[model samples]
Target: MVNWSLKAIDYEVYNGVTVGDLILVFAILFIAFLIAKIIAMSLRRSLADKMKKGEIEALVKFVYAVVMLTAIVTVTPILGLNLTGLLVAGGIAGIAIGFASQKVVSNLLSGLFLIAERPVKIGDQIIVGNVAGFVEDMKIMSTIIRTYDGLYVRIPNETLFTSNITNPAANSARRFDYTINVRYMDDAEKAIRIIKNVIEEHPFALKIPPPRVFVDSLGESGMSIVVNIWAPSSEWTDVKMDLLWKIKIELERNGIQIPTKRNLA
Candidate 1:
């Protein structure tokens, strides 16, 4: 009558792994997993506004791996299993695998540095190592890019880290230049005024750093007039195309010759 049922529940299984021990082990492991998840979620919440999606994902994965490894090591001995041989075997295997995939490891490390350094971000228009595209996704080993023509490219992180990266979207404004050729007889000063007027008429071009048009060089066929304008980077392409069209139309309306040898000389 002295809690016989409880006594029966305390039966041993094998090699110090009793019924109670099994229950305790499960509880410990369950708590460990839950704690790991909680910590991962907390880190996500805390860094949500600070880091990119890729960085957060990597950090969460790293945290979970460390937590689970610690829990496995702590509970292994309690389960009455000898890990002496297993540890030795695992160490040797790990070393072998590490050496075999050294380049993969290098890419992984480079990806981490890419995240930390943040030379480019998702959706940024960039040119890296002869590839030009908007970043689609940043992964641990490689980066995905969507080219202007819609081709998808995957660049290894090692290449991305080592190569030169050009981010045109990083700055607020960009410059576009056009070398306009005209007959030597065409009034250079008048042509300059016409180009400046067209630039001013267009709203996208920056005004504070006024556009300039001048004779850059003198050639046998014509005068090499140079036009330089700065516009907001976001509208760079549109403005560039529009300005070229406008300049050509004005030059033609004023009967300015582009001085082709066939037409002028």
Candidate 2:
């Protein structure tokens, strides 16, 4: 029984490829995978602050693939495969497959371009096509987005490349407008002055572009006052929410009220 087991362990599988060769192939592959994982972990730690999460992941995946492919090619000889002939055959097959999968090629090229161009980065809130969300990851073939409502969306690179992308975070500053209505009986000039003071009090509101407050239109219920305020894009949402209520409160304190239809009647 021991002799038979020893013979089975040392037997040649095919083409002079023994059981030892198979074991060596697996060992090399395991080593390659371990090395790849170690390198990826090291890179993530080194580039955490220097690069975005999506970029780091993309780079790590690329490195891992290259390492595994190299190991595979190197171990092919253990299985009695020829590298030179395989490369030549692979080149011809790649060309034929490339022609057949034009869209796949296009997506791959688009992904490369996006990584290089960096029109939109990971964590950027963007609206591409009909989807509006924060970019979760930028992959080689597609992009992942986490929507405002917390749904994950995958967009193909080809579609992203061809579509219009609106990245509000790209700008240092952004403008938001509010159409505030005041009672027609209230002094329009006084309301304007009060609104300006409120904007000036807010730290996020930009003073360079200046705040614009003026009577836009006279409606049946009240006078429509246009309020255009500029704030840093990063804080625009908070500024919009915080300053708007303040404006209303300040106006009310100054004896300027938002007239209702009942009051007009």
Angstrom error of the Cα, residue 29, model 1: value is: 11
Q: Could you tell me every candidate's TM-score relative to the true structure?
A: 0.72, 0.64
Query: What is every candidate's alpha-carbon RMSD to the true fold?
Result: 6.0, 9.9
Please give the clash total of every predicted structure, in order: 0, 0
Off by over 4 Å in 1: 1-42, 46-59, 67-96, 100-105
CA-lDDT, candidates in order: 0.86, 0.88
Error of 2 at 145 (Å): 1.7
Compose the digit string of candidate 1's lDDT tens values, residues 67-166: 8888888888878988988878799887888787788768877887887788998888999877898999888788999998999999999999999999
Which tens-of-lDDT digit does each residue in 42-93 have in candidate 2?
A: 9789767646788789878877998999999999988999888766879988
Q: After superposition, how far is residue 111 of candidate 1 from its true place, in Å?
A: 3.4
